[model samples]
Target: MPKTCFDPAASMASAALSESTLSGPTMGTRWAVRYQAPPDFDHGALSRDLALTVESVDAQMSPWKPESGLMRLNRSEPGQWVALPADLLGVLARAVQIGALSGGAYDAAIGDLVNAWGFGAVRDAPDPAAIRRAAASHRPAHLWLDIDGERARARKRMPMTLDLCGIAKGYAVDRMAQVMDRHGVAHALAGLDGELRACGARADGRPWAVALESPQEGRRAAHGVIELVDLSVATSGDYRHWIRVGSERLAHTMDGRRAAPVRNPVASVTVLAASCMDADAWATALLVAGPGEGPALAQRMGLDALFLLRCEGRLTEIGLGRFAAHPCRARIAAATPAP
Candidate 1:
């Protein structure tokens, strides 16, 4: 493990959000907003504004929200074009772009399948035959968006549900960071549910230190740590949000191709990218790709990725060339003994 140091004095206050926060003992779970500007940067107000922006977008886009624009469109007759807000249109375009790049591993139109699997608003044991039928209607290609007019319409009569849970938070983080930057916040870190972006080093020029959580049970220490500046990191793992079906455990992440839970020994995969959306989608895609092919794909795409595998109660890490250059803090201590 390589040791990367972050200055505690410069660490910003973390805001609680949907995911658990384990970066620091007191951090807990929240949407953290840290900025390197005036002490009275109005982060609380900024967070509230960002949350409202997200909520408004959700109201217009989330299929789970019955009153959302998407649901309204779903209920409306065909040939009816629903006017979309600019924000919703932007996110929809991003979703389509990522879906195409990842080969549908990360899809926003899988709301029906997600609901069938009891992962969405409606929770029930889904029938295999029904699952296939629901999945057939969940293709992203069926979605049509006119960015200029901010309008969206589905070509098929099939009920189309859009769930932005996969990429929304990361996109929110980016938006919030923009807000901070506009306020002249030179050094800051915006993170929501482990998807984080570090704008720059602290005022003193110290890089931000981020730790990767161990995927194994009863392991409290970080698997690794990295010093970052102007970078974004996101992790996806089966350890969280999983259900046991018979003797096998299934993760919430589904392979759009097979319409089944990913069966891979890979415990977790973390990615560092230019944006959280890229990192978030790539993390899910790699998890679906499994261990062997996942790392290779990351390399082929010229991405920096770290893979952690659990074998016999221990964690083994495999890093691509780019990720390997970063030192693993935990490993360093094990190799060095006290005098």
Candidate 2:
């Protein structure tokens, strides 16, 4: 499906039963599946299949797993041709495309850089030289994929340390949705971490309402809510997954241009797209683009994004494209680009 622009008035929902929820753990986080189960559907078997699917994806892409496919590739020498599974290959391809389109803002090849920043399990700061070397290795520029053969190779001398942390969960959500579809289920809201995808509607005929969290630190309040059907939404924020590097606190999100986490004035970015993977990738890209360029870039790209910027100790929000129609829409911060 192509990317879509959300239209509130035009977006309606078809009714379906909402019953039987299943959830489990994956990729260091929890995944939930809320769906309308068919009468003949086996809830127990469906749950197992869903768990297995998520486990397979994690084994293929998780950097924390030493024996994972991505970690194996990372251990391989730069010139080595790694035989990638279809899932990893597809994610690499999409990551490369988004990285190129975002001018390296959405790079997946900065896995080593992330680890060096002590954002992984380690807490101490890494050597300065390692960080510099990691920054020099950009995924879109160096990772080569042979789509026809279903394998990929790295053209550079660095290891293939590609991290799918930003987008893998979204793909997992899509897979959950696929699983639900296969089992003759409908009206599902599948989510992993900060990404969510919804389809059809509840028995009451109302679309799923997703809450957007406020970007403030230590706050768990919802800033806005939007009704969505058959659409995926993802948000990237610096509020979580950050490490304090001496006096400076650095986020896990890395920017290839600076070879460091984005230092932009933006606090968070939420993107709505046809697919959860695209939404996840674009949310990171838009957050890295920051307030100055994000709104303009989002406008030009026809992307539906909601940006929360940190300005002078206060957070200001700006909505682009369809986000304007979101319920609880805040005052339009002046820095937002004109539509």
Candidate 3:
């Protein structure tokens, strides 16, 4: 469940651009693409190119799409080699890198557990037995990616599902940004849902100001803010898409280690990475790791991260050293009193 928020107030110069919404299944959720390009940009032509990019990726990678190339491979009886798309192979390789670096805190094979806990395709409360089974099956190490001569194979016969929601959006954003850059749109922002990548300034000389949404339920105030330029930002939190199991509340974020919802003081984590995919994956990883380990990991990885924790019904900002330097002036001013 990813959401996007943009401050159109930040864009200055208005161009004659075409806008359209493209809806489809991505990252186990409905994806709505709101694309804007120059009016002369040829809506049909641009849509065709972008749609083909997305569809080609989905055909080879979507586990939900039964006839997808990945499904074909998953359903293969045994010891069968299914040729993989270059894009899928590239994504899997990066997933492996993140999984290893984060000590398995970030995983691509946690799909079954996510679904069992009412967080994926089937949104129903799962029984203890089902949870246990799903937990046991949530290991990225079990999956194999052998890129040999344009073919990739899963070495093990265990049931596996690859949900790339954590990283796919960022990758797509990056790809779209590249497309725009190639067309000489040096100053534009392209996003899918709120995972965004910005290029140059927004038709002006100022950087994009992103409001960090307060994690408080039903509240719309900015907890903080950050100015971004030529970078991507992704945030993950437990406040949305959660389930109540008895007296305890469970979030959609699953800890691959225990295959259960993470209980941490860190209510939300926002990461500034070179790519939205990296930011997204790191934000999830840090949130699961909790406040202490999260900040430490961010420091080690040289990431700009801000952690928000709810204390006594108030939001507190806890930033790694780097984040403090890039504070959102609006939020800081709001926190200050008039003399």
Candidate 4:
């Protein structure tokens, strides 16, 4: 018999369950699932289902897709009640809620600003004239977007372009978790891009470990690891997607209030929440809030977040809520063992 990768005693009783992993492309990135399943299980069908799940989300919410449900609403007339898919509507509603809670720091109605800054579908260089217009015309979605849950429709009180880039990916991750549960996979890990959720403990009775990425551009290294058991975590940072303007670097994340890329010393913010959607949005919100009010907001909201701030050319980790109890230390180069 083949040896189980997990503890022998732990797996002896559940010998039918075998460790499995599945991955596919999504949102210009990739999604991965790890789980223990029966040897006879049809993993091929499950993999296809997972791919279709994420593809459905992209079809409904992708700003790059001209025929996506989100873009159709974007092209709709102001004050028009546009019909939207249930998933898109729910995500939009939640995005607005988070935007209000974050004091307009995480608005979903920044599509125009995003495009003007060359981060959206256009992907062109930032246009100064369009940037100024978008800046002057910026409005928070919470104030103008109205949702009719009963009718599965929404209307914009003012003219605005809805962008779910900040929140939809996390929602997709949540959906993937749901798909796993429906498939009767009790212990699984679902992830899209960097957003992740653990369904249960590992086969060895240990939590799934996820790496905390160091906020360094053009380099990939782990700052630490998070042991997750039935929890979700996400990180938002400027390191991954940014454009250099002379000496200034502009991140892809837009600040709706400022109508510009976030300008702060916060290198990144990682948030742990019950749902990946909340984790993803809050991460972006806190990063937009910067180090000052971000910690305060996290305290008030009782959120567990780690803010990696840039100070004197070194990384400083600020923990809130549960993170404060067990602080994660940044790994220094001097401490690394030489290869």
Candidate 5:
């Protein structure tokens, strides 16, 4: 699970500033927002509107919901055109772009693989042939997007099982931040699961502090505290979302290249990008590239990243680019974790 390092000064400032925070259910997880607003801010009404906004996104993109808009599109036959909602089309477009950029390592077209691994709404033990077929079909390039009409069509051979699990939550977080901005709140912090985005700064003009957790299963220890200002942070880890199959722990992150659960030395990958959507997507991509190569990928993509690995119960942290800007206690561990 992701952890946040609470700054003591921020705690004291929280008491000094007039802040409003709201939390609610979203995307099989939860979302929370904290901002400095007017003393008479309509907390109840604003919270309700924000929750509905997230629910709308979930209805359009959740793979767990059989009747969701994305799921409905999944049910359509190949070569059939799907009149997708604006939001759904937007996400699909971004996913396809990122997939191609990462050489298919960050594909969002892996719903069948997700289901076969028992991580989706429908779960099944994947046979060898099914796994191969699923792996071969994870090419988002096969789907053609008509942005002008907000529609998408899959080629006859490509299965249209697009899974937005990695990106939707970040989009929701971005949407929530937009909602808050529309309501005239300037400085705010928002988060969904492990995806976090910040806008402006605190009332005292300091960055928001969040705890970065060690990638040790069942251990909620904070490995470092990051100060984010007007940027988004995301951590993708095998330990957080996984299944115990007999003696093996199967992670939710499937390698698009392998068409199987990723087997990398780095236990977790945290990326800081201009938007949460980019941070979220790239983290998964770099994690698949393995610890040895992930840092290079981040540097090439111009992303700031933090990676954690366990070697004989000792945790090692590696920071690249802007991740080194902060003087956290784990400052001098050599960069990159290798298997």
Candidate 6:
């Protein structure tokens, strides 16, 4: 179910409009779209179109596919330009922009680190040798990756592997929403994993609701609900994907500066933005920044973010921007410590 979920109450409303659900598998997870349509609406055609839209994204950006544009670019030699699809180039450009904005906290050149940590295509136990080698030779993607949007081409200036896992799913979700728009489905919600975008209000004229998951390692629970209207939400948490090492667990998300799994008190970070792509990338950047530096950065960037921290066996939350006014419902007995 990922973290974001539609409110069943609104979805189950039996109005003149009927609910149509479309779903398919992509990026090792399922994508779903729910829209309200008139009785005569062609849901079948819309479903097929939605599936194709996400498939196109997978084809261009998936690292698991050897023929994918991203993989081809990864295999290219330094200083060799590779003409890429517009969508891939756009995502790469945005990654570079966000990487610079986050002070290198968010990076797309961590493919080697992702694989070494067993979070990439080949899922195995973390390799100590690979981890050491990747850390020793790590560099931020912005410094080594070059993008020429006018030419729809990109090239690596150094030996680096590119990965788009942090933002690709959200971009796919955005593409799904665009497909719905093309089909004239105005009232809809589209999502991949925890990243979600709403085109408009539900059939009943209520804003679409998304649940925020509590960052607990062994279970799934809703920490809060956000009413979304023409907005996107993404959550990056340490609880979901991690590797256990003795008594400690290492998160899948890498801190580019450290070239290792993020080790901080921050358990999760949720961001709301106009685009799912921005929400997704910013959430990852803020999570890697942790409590010490995350809040300040979010404030400076004017991002709506909710940061959950695990302190002394209790959960603490610090909200900024819109989240500051609308705090999560789940509460612990202890007060939140200053970030």
* 10 residues in a row with least lDDT, candidate 4: 330-339
RMSD of every candidate to native, in Å, equals 6.5, 5.3, 6.1, 4.4, 4.9, 4.9
Whole-model Cα lDDT of every candidate shown, in order: 0.65, 0.75, 0.67, 0.86, 0.76, 0.88
Native-vs-model 5 lDDT? 0.76
Worst 10 residues of 5 by lDDT: 329-338
| Candidate 2: tens digits of C-alpha lDDT, residues 96-185 | 788777767787777777777666756667668878777675444324432333335433345446778888998888888888778866
Consecutive 10-residue window with the lowest summed lDDT within model 3: 330-339
In candidate 2, list every pair of residues with a backbone clash: none
lDDT, model 1? 0.65
The list of candidate 5 runs beyond 4 A from truth reads: 1-17, 122-133, 136-157, 325-339
**Model 2 off-target regions past 4 Å?**
1-18, 38-41, 136-160, 325-339
lDDT of 4 by residue, 1-339 (tens): 122246777666456688899999988899999998888888998898899999999999998899999989888888899899999999988988998898988889999999899887557789999999998887789898998989999988888998888898899999999999888887899998899999987766667788888888898888778878788999999999988877888999998888999999998899999899999999999999999999999888899998888887778878886676643321122212111
* Per-residue lDDT of candidate 5, residues 1-339 (tens digit): 133466787666655558778999888789999888767777777788789989999999988788887887778776667676878778877877777777777877777888777787655554567777777666554244323332353322355577888888888888888888888777899999989999877866667888877676776766667777788988898887888777887889988667789887778889888888988988888888787777877778777888776666566777887767655412333432322
Tally clashes: model 1.
13
Judge candidate 6 at residue 317 and give its lDDT.
85
Cα lDDT for residue 234, model 5? 88
Decide which is better by TM-score, 4 or 5: 4
- Residue 231 in candidate 6, Cα distance off native in Å: 0.3
Backbone clash numbers for all candidates listed = 13, 0, 1, 0, 2, 0
TM-scores for candidates 1 onward, in order: 0.78, 0.85, 0.81, 0.93, 0.86, 0.92
Using TM-score as the measure, which candidate wins? 4
Candidate that would win on lDDT: 6
* Cα misplacement distance, residue 266 of candidate 4 (Å): 0.5
Residue 234 lDDT (model 2): 94
Task: Evaluate model 6: give its TM-score.
Answer: 0.92
